[model samples]
Target: MTDTHTPRGLAETYFLCWRRRDFTDLAPHLADEVAFDGPLASVRGREDCLEGLVGLARATTHLEVERRLVDENDVMTWFSLGVGGSEPTPVVNWCHVEDGRIRAIRVAFDPRGILAAG
Candidate 1:
């Protein structure tokens, strides 16, 4: 197992934790004041961020990561978020790391299909 202290390692670890729906493992990788921003939701703080991710995980059927680009404390990951039975949604998650913990996350994606389904 890769040590989750590095920015790249932490980002990769997050996917593994998300896949297993293991918030316990993921929580330690996030900063206490972590912030989350995405097209569907925006939240601040570790607990709220974890809660929002857990809620999203409920709809997640699969996560296929295609690539990861790392630059110092910033890691940008591109993946397909398979939600339920519908086609996967292509997503880009950019994470900023500080002191070996994820301090902020910004996600981008087209929400039209998801909104139409609602």
Candidate 2:
């Protein structure tokens, strides 16, 4: 595994942690004050972000990520999440980093699709 300081390395590490549902491992990659925006709600701060991830993991399975782009301090990842035996939902994740930790994340997915089935 590569060092977590680099953008691509951080993306790989983040994805690995996500796949394992290891929130603790993922925490180190997030800034103390992080901003997360997704289909469900917008959240700020590391605690809120972690809480949201935990809640999401409880409702999701078979989460897989596809790396789209990796630059100096930004990464674009595409993910497919299978929720409660439904079809795998597609999402685009954009992450911005500073000092090896994620400062911001924006996720785009079909909220209607998520809400329709839930």
Off by over 4 Å in 1: none
lDDT on C-alpha atoms for all candidate structures: 0.89, 0.81
Highest lDDT model number: 1
Model 2 lowest lDDT segment of ten: 13-22
Candidate 2, clashing residue pairs?
Answer: none
Question: What tens-digit string does per-residue lDDT give for candidate 2 at 23-55?
Answer: 787787899999999878899999999888778
Local distance difference test, candidate 1: 0.89
TM-score, predicted candidate 2 vs. hidden true structure: 0.88
Q: Alpha carbon lDDT of residue 11, candidate 2?
A: 71
Best by TM-score: 1
